[model samples]
Target: MRTRTRIAPVALAAVLVAGGTMLAAGQAGAAPKAGPAVKATCYGGAKYYTSTAGGGSSNAHWPATGTWAYTTSNCNDINVKSDVSLSVKVCFKKTGSCNGWTSAKAGVWTVVAKDVLHGSGFYLQFNRTSSSKGWIAY
Candidate 1:
């Protein structure tokens, strides 16, 4: 023969509430916090740019126009957009030695490339080969 023990309703409710509170507290502490914003600096005519540093994306310049060059310290997503015809060249190891290039026609946003960065740095050359327009990167 076997006997079973049942928990009282009040006791079960208390246990559940305690477990839920513990879980809620743990979740609250585990939540990620937002950090300070990164600032991007640009040279040449390029209007917007973003670069990766310390394994995080930083140095973001927005509303960029004309030709510009950007760099990244690690493998991070590089996004580019334009309101006019534009072309981009990606350099894996160095800026001068380009690995690939892509172009966007008319006024449209293009992803350009994704996670093509290296530890040393990857260079992006955005050439606004058309009318006056603006672009952004992240």
Candidate 2:
């Protein structure tokens, strides 16, 4: 009887080990995950804004959140590009004050590399204006 009991325990252990091994092997064959698409065009980020009558002030207009702002602006300009276009909300004085902030649809500041401009980057922003394309880095 003791011999029989010992043999049963040994058999049960072997079966449990085999089952565990099979479960581990099955884990390796799980499904693969997906991701974002690859871009065929050169990448250049920009911000777009809708024109506002007031913005905030006569010269400088700062639009509050959810406000219809100015048109899309290119930050690559040298002449105060950072202060006007995009999500530009220039304080009449300090940075915290939303004094004269021009509202924009979306603000995107893209960095265009020299090589990228010649290739895929060219296609990203073909509709941009010459004034929009500036040497300044915003």
Q: Which candidate has the highest TM-score of all?
A: 1
Put down candidate 1 lDDT per residue, 1-138, tens digits, no spaces: 122234466678889999999998886665433111121321122245332211133222222323344434321345455555656655544544664667866555455566554343444554532233345443
lDDT per residue, candidate 2, 1-138, as tens digits?
999999999999999999988887665443222111111111133333222233223332223333322222222221122323443332222123332333333233333222111111111111112112221222
Report the Cα lDDT for candidate 1: 0.46
Candidate 2 displacement at residue 107 in angstroms: 22
RMSD for all candidates, in order, please.
Answer: 12.2, 16.1
lDDT of each: 0.46, 0.31
TM-score of each: 0.36, 0.25
